[model samples]
Structure formats: structure tokens, C-alpha cells
Target chain A: MLRLHGIVGDRRDHALHHRLHHLEHHDAIEFLFVPEADLGRRRLRALTDRGTECAVSLDRDDALYDGAVLFIDDDRAVVVRAGAPRELRLRPQGTEGALKLGFLAGHLHWRVRFEGTDLCVVLDGAAADYTARIAPLLDDGIVTVVGNAN
Target chain B: MNAPALSPATPAKTAPAARVGIGGPVGSGKTALVERLIAAFAARKVDLAVITNDLVTHEDAERVRRSGLIDPARVSAVEAGACPHTVIREDPTLNIEAADDLERRFPGVELILIESGGDNLASTFSRDLTDFWIFVIDVAGGDDIPRKRGPGVLKCDLLVINKADLAPHVGVDLDGMIAEARRVRAGRPVIVTNCRRSEGIDAVADHLEREVLFRT
Candidate 1:
């Protein structure tokens, strides 16, 4: 298993981006897709798209972000790609219910947006976990789970 | 002048300190327990640091720093704002950053005691923030507390029943409270302590040394 200690650069860096583009033409770019929740973790073990096993142990203060470049060599490059954002769509029963639901989401610091009458919440973890926090509102019919937005 | 050259990524030189969280209701002796543990670990010659999450003020952090049990510089304070539980459990980025700063400053630190602001029984420490956590409850809070089975009590690595000396005055049966706590925790470790008198503190330190630090 190859042990990755830190991020060399990110794809957003122009030099690295150009290098990645050049490497792609040679079929030498591999990607590791990391989930949103796991980004904050300092230690992780995952396999690349080509089935190469690697262990990542970042510094205490460092967090993994999208497009992190883990390793690069003359022949190949390894990059990290964050998974797609997962979200839950909810509809409150009334104005008061919307206020309460909004308050709860704000208190929990959940990233959310309003779309028509629905509240779309970007989830950091499982959808069930977010719903569980608002279970009382659901049981009382103050809010209803419309569906997954993504 | 020569241009600086890029260096290859290097692994972290040392492991981060073990983080332990102490959480409980208002006036449940969370700060008192932190002070006591500071003394206990100091006596054991363990390198330590502390982070206190005060709801609106730095009162708890100031108190710990003034105790003189550890270096004042080693103590860090985090304002948890209105949501105490949220800072420790939901969005613990502030606390994580504080702990990381302490580790960076004190490389020899073996443990960091994170004291949460007083909160409700539903409060818990996120696994990403704490390696081990203890929920502190007092006898005066009522003997029914354990039977209520809040997540903080049921899920903590250790449960502490503080202010045991007040059990008689508060009409709380200490033995029954301990038994009920053990029952709710499904036979997990529970230690009774009177922080004012420093009683049963060694037991708590022993548990930390064995379970968290793996010193045993």
C-alpha cells in the first residue's frame, strides 16, 4: 500500500492543471473519489480508479478538498475528487412550520436553500440522520419529506 | 537570489494528542472535573493541554488557566455561542481547530481535555472531535436522570456521577443512582466522584490512562 502524507497541489493550480491535462493525453491520470463527510478526516484508506491501494494521513490542521493532487510523477498523476453533493427536499405545512423548520436547520448549521415552497438541505451525512433531527416536526405534520433533491 | 524550490510532501512528524471530551448539564461540575483531571495528570507526569467551550464568555477557560495546574499558554478557549451541543457535536470545526493549534504549539502533549459548556442531557461529542468522552451528572440533578437515558449518558465512553457527597442532602440515593447509571449504560464503567474533595479522581485518571492513552 502506498502511503500519502500530504497534498502536493490542487487541480485549481494552473501549473498542476496544465500538467494534469498533459498527463490525461497519455492515459496516466488516476482519481480517488472521496465522500463529503470523509473530507474532514485526517486519516483515510481508499483505492484509486485503477485499483491502486493508498492510505492518506494528512496533517492535523489540513482537510481534504475537491481536486486535491496527492501524487504526481513523470509518468502518472493521482488526484482526489469529491463525491456529488447529497440533499434532501422538505416542505413545511404552513408559514409557522416553515419558520420552525428554518430555525432548526439554522441552529444545526445545515447548509440549506429555499426553492419555491420546499427547503433543500445539503447533507453532510446520511439523509436519515438529518431527518432524525427533525423527527418531531415530521411526526406532528409540521413538515414533510418531499424527496431527495439529488 | 535563488528561487525557492518545491519540496515533496512529508508525513507529519508526530501523532496528534488524544482528545477527550467532558460534557454535562449546567452546574454539573464539568469545569471542576477538568481542574481535578489537570491535577491528577500533572501528578502522573503526563503532558497535557485543555480547551474549554464557554457558551458566551471565557469564564471556564480563565478558571482553568488560573488554576496553575498546567501552563496558562497551553489552555485554549472557544466561544460556543448559543448552541453548546452544536459546537461539540454538529459543527465542531471550531473545537477541532483549537485542538489542532494546541497540538502544533505543544508537540509533547499526550492528551487534551475538551470541556463542553453546560448543556442539556441530549448533548454528545462528535466522533470526529473526540477519541473518548465522558458525561458528568450530579446527584442533585435527581436520581431519575439515569433512568431517563439521554444519549449523553447512554453513549459516553464513561459516565461520572459527581457531587456524591450531596446525595443525602439532596434526597438522592447514591448507590441506586450508580446502579441505574450502570444499567442504562449496559454495564459500562461509571465512577462516582466528589470534585470538591478530590475523591475518586484517581479512578477517573486510571480509566483515561488505560482506555484512552493505552498506558496500561
Candidate 2:
């Protein structure tokens, strides 16, 4: 299990904007003092060893986690796992690919709700008809509990 | 305190230009209520856009788009995927993105009314998502509704008592319902409307002017 604690008190929150603007400046990168941000080094190492460029989340809201499939290193835009993250790993059919998915699935605070055709979506909180939809996603590994911070 | 240094320097995101949310139980005239607000706001030259969520399809959004009240492009539909409250309240990132996209496409838009997929008496909007939100419940829904004190009834900025025209037919007392709603809300604001005939829309718009646009 990846233990990423100390995020609640970290000042990295202030630098997200600066990094978002700078080419060399990366938001959530070198900005995270939170120990809970890292997925276990073993999994990330195995994937990188197989040439899969992996990114761990530095904050919860860079995107809502309800239906998150994977994070990309290039732009960090979350995608529905359209086999895109698999392609990032030069070896598509290796343990590295499966391990990445494992790390994502194991995370409880990742905040995603799985839907039709296995579409993992960033959960919507404002909708009135939202409860009925999230009920089942909670049962599927697709939905996870996340975002305890203010 | 270092207020400026604590928050991002970027311009704070303002509330969407035009957002009017119609929330009520299934068939309390949420869609019909939206149609009337569209026509009323339009009559005043308020540029507008709309969003609707349904159980499984574009049923609500498509209905409005076909009404010819507004351009089809101005109307967008979001599938609730089951949870209606979540899309409008807790984490409204998707709705925010949709409203932002609408504002980008139609810079002239003065309002974007978000109609919640019909929900129960307990539903309400989060301030983070909307500058102003209106809750629609009908006299026919029962005068006891206001007395029950659901969050949607009490918390909305404006509590709209719709379907007033049908009150007598359904044995509802419009006057008493309005009085009770006012009492429960601690006299914030309430409007009665017969959306089917466009009655009482002016009061609703007037409330918007005073409360949302600060026209007063």
C-alpha cells in the first residue's frame, strides 16, 4: 500500500498555479510534500521498467476520480483507459500493465464511479438524480471513496 | 492574514452568467417551468441557454430543444447516470464545464438556467455551482409540502409554487400553500405561477433581478 500522508499540511497547494503556467514548472510535481501522494514505488517502478510512463496524482481535484481510468505523463489529462495507458507501456502485454491497473483499483480515495461500457467518470455532486446512479457504482470496483480534505 | 498570497492570483471564477435551476419532484412541472422561464426571460431580451438531465436518455433536454423557444445549440443534455443531486450539488465540475462551454460559444448569454432532473422534496443546489437556484413545487403536489420542510423547499433562494391554475382542480389551496411556504422559509421569498398560462412569471423574474442581477 502506498502511504501518502502529510498532504493536509503541505504548502504545495500554492504552487499548482505557477507550475500550471510554467513549461519547466509542473503542478503537483516537486510540489507534493504529502506522503500519501505516491503509489507504491514497486508498482510505479515495475511499469517504468517496462517503459510505461506513469504519473501519480498529487492532488484530488486536478480531476474528480469517480471514473478515472489512468493518468498520462505528457499532459496529465485523465482518460477512460481506451487502451491508451496500455500503449504508454512499450510492452502492452506485460505485468507492468496489469500492475498499474492494480494500484489504481486498490486506492480507496481515488473517487470514481464506473458506468455503462465500463466508463469511469468523475463523479458529479450537484445533480439531483445523482444518488440513484452512484448506488451501483459504489458496489463496482469502478467507484471508490476519496476527497476528505476541505 | 496573507489573503492575497493564500489564494491563486488568477481572477476568481464568477458564477455562470445565466443559471436558473428548476427543481421539483418528478412531474411537478420542472421542464414546463423551464420553458416558461425561457419565454419570460426571452421576452425581456435575456440571452439564455439550458441544460437538462433525465433518468436514461435526453428526454427532458430534447423536449425543450424541440420547443423552438431557444436555439437547439443553446440546449445541452446531460445523462444523470442515476444520481441527480450529485450533478447539480456536491461536485459540479461537469456542469461548470458545460456552462463555461455555453458561455464561450454564446458570449451574449446573460443566463443559463440549469434544470435539475426531477427529484424529491429533499433536493437542493450547492452554492459552489450556481449563483442563484430556484426550487419549483406545485400546489397540486400538496400544500403540506412546504410544511414538511424539505431542504429544497426551505433552502432555495426562491421557492416557486407552480401549477397554481390546477390547484382548484386538484383540491389544493393556493393562498394557504404560499402562506405556509413563506412561513417555513422565514419570509425569504416565494412566487406563485401557472406556467401553463405564463401567469406569475414576472414576479419570478423580478426576484431574479433583485436577488441575482442586483438590478434594484
Candidate 3:
């Protein structure tokens, strides 16, 4: 990712940076989901607006937090949403279940938090559909709805 | 090739000072190591300067400056602005600028040591910013640290297990810890040190002279 390189300074990269800067003010808003672990990492992203795609370079030593505005101007701003781009919630049976769920969440690069005995996971939407196959690996933890996130 | 008339008369850029990064978790003896290095390098007469990064304060820089080991003027402080690792790895522009400034102020400085703000094992220095880096961890932090095999432990140019004299007091198996570190690094250099007693420091200096400074 270009942003992972630190700063976008070359003329070509500068032009794209300015273009994205302009898009930040337009009515068409795009969502960039930032995982908790990636909050402090440097990276580049590509965004599309009405079939036109452009690169957005985040080149500063900046930390991305949930609800932090990624881009802003007088008219509108693009904000960050916390959690995985997709997610799943599971109700674990006990301590072993919690450990299994935690291990799976880490292995899958899913951000997870516990609500009492319930495991709330933020991960890929596709993985949520595999609830039938995943439950057996989690020490009999039951799968819940896939889309719910905070 | 035809060039502008002014280009031919322009002075060529000088070589920048070699930069070394010191990074480790909080309370891991990074500052202590820096203090020792200051004295060691000074005795060798290596023209050097230092840069210290702190989260919100210049405490580490102040400490080094007040230690009287090196000139206070040679030490610079950088505030990491809450993202400690980001300043060193993700975007090292600020540190680069500081190192450049040091080179400017103390012309002919051969080396610059950049001390990162105390952070977790995930922290590392950007190669673009540092020519070489040393990761310092202590025996008191527990032997499991090597088993964890964080990127810092595996990737640092040199790994320093500091506070070795405390191994007996802390119930750490010194040889076992060093053995695991060697295993994880696959024979990369790992140095055991007791900064408090100034033990095993010459080896570090020798490694830097050969590896970083190419001094033989």
C-alpha cells in the first residue's frame, strides 16, 4: 500500500492525494472499516465513487480509531467504523469455549471482545455463514447472528 | 547530457551519519543501555549524537542529558504523540529530520543513536530510518518472552538480553533463555549483558564496529 510507505510526495501521488481530498467534500460518502489492531499501522487504500476508482494515501504517523474522521472538508467527511468489515457473535459454553473462541478469532485475524460468556467477533462475513462447521471446533459453542456489530 | 549552468557548481551532498535504533518494552533497561553506550562510544572517540523518543514528555532525553555522559547539546528529544511505534516504523520522517539536524549541528558526526519510546515487542525501526537496530529485553520479564518470538526478538539486527545478573534473583535460567533466543534467531547474534556492572559491553561495541561502522 502506498500509504504504508510513509508519505505520498511524488507529483503523480500528489495528484491522487488532491483528488481524494476533493472527494472528501462530495456528497457520495465511502466507509473504511479499520480493525483495532490496524489502528496504528500505515497503509494505502483504493476507493471507488460512481465507477471511478482512486487511491487514498494515509501517509502520516497517525493512529486510526473508531469514529475518527479519515478525511474532512467544509461540506462532509469520511469517518472510520470500528470492528471487522464483517463479523460474527457466538455464545460460548464455558472457559474452554472462551479460550477456543479466542484462539480461533486470533488465528482468523478477527477482533473479538467478550460480553459476559458471549464472544462478539468482528471478522469476514463469509466466515459467519460457516457457523455449522465452526461450532464443532469451538467446544460446542453456539453460533448466533452474523451481522450484529457495535 | 546538457545540464543547467548552476548545477555544475552545486556542492555534492555529504554522507549522512549512520543511525542506530534502540527499542524494547518499558522497564527493559533501554535507558540504562543507552547510558552505557554513551560512555563506551565516547571512549572510542566516535563522533556521535543521540535522539530519544518519549510519548508525551522529554523525560528520557532529559535523563540522558543530565547524566553528563555525553554533551547535553548532542541529545535531542522527539515526542511520539501517543503512537510510539508509528514514529519509528510506520513513518520515521520526524526521526529522520532530527537525525539530519544533528548531523548539521555537529558536522562529521559518524553515528546517531535513536532511542525509541518504551513500547511492546511489536515495535520496530524502519530500515529507511535506521542503519542498524538493537532490541533489548530483560531476564526479569520472564523466559517465555523468547518463546513468544515477537517480531522484535526475531528481526532485530542484534538482540540484547540485559540485566543478566538478576537471573538468579528472578529465577530465570540464563542459559536456557539464551539458548531459546539463539534457536528463534537461527544463530543470529544474541548478547547477554549486565549493564549495571558494565559486563559484556565490549562485545556489543565490537559488533557495532564491525557490522555497523565497518571499522574491522
In DockQ terms, which candidate is top? 1
C-alpha root-mean-square deviation, each candidate: 15.4, 18.8, 15.4
Off by over 4 Å in 1: A1-150, B1-13
Q: What DockQ does each prediction reach against the true complex?
A: 0.05, 0.01, 0.01
lDDT of 2 by residue, A13-101 (tens): 35433333342122212111112222211111112111232322222123212223232233322221111121011111244433443
TM-score attained by model 3: 0.56
Q: Mind giving the per-residue lDDT tens digits that candidate 2 earns over B58-142?
A: 9988899999999999998887787788888877777777877898999867678888888998887765456568888988788
1 versus 3: better DockQ goes to: 1
Q: What is the lDDT of residue B187 in candidate 3?
A: 97
Could you give candidate 3's per-residue lDDT for residues A121-140 as a string of tens digits? 54434663546446675434
What lDDT tens digits, residue by residue, belong to model 3 across residues B43-118?
9988889999999999999999999999999999999997789999999989989998998799998788999999
Top candidate by TM-score: 1
- Give the candidate order by descending TM-score: 1, 3, 2
User: Model 1, B1-216: lDDT tens per residue?
Assistant: 111122343344454677889999999999999999999999999999999999889999999999988899999999988789999999999999999899889888989999999998999988689767899999999999999999999988799999999999999989999999999898989999999999999999999887666455
The predicted structure with the larger TM-score, 2 or 3, is 3
Runs off by more than 4 Å, candidate 3: A1-150, B1-14
Q: Chain A only: list TM-scores of all candidates.
A: 0.55, 0.19, 0.36
Which one wins on lDDT? Answer: 1
Off by over 4 Å in 2: A1-150, B1-16
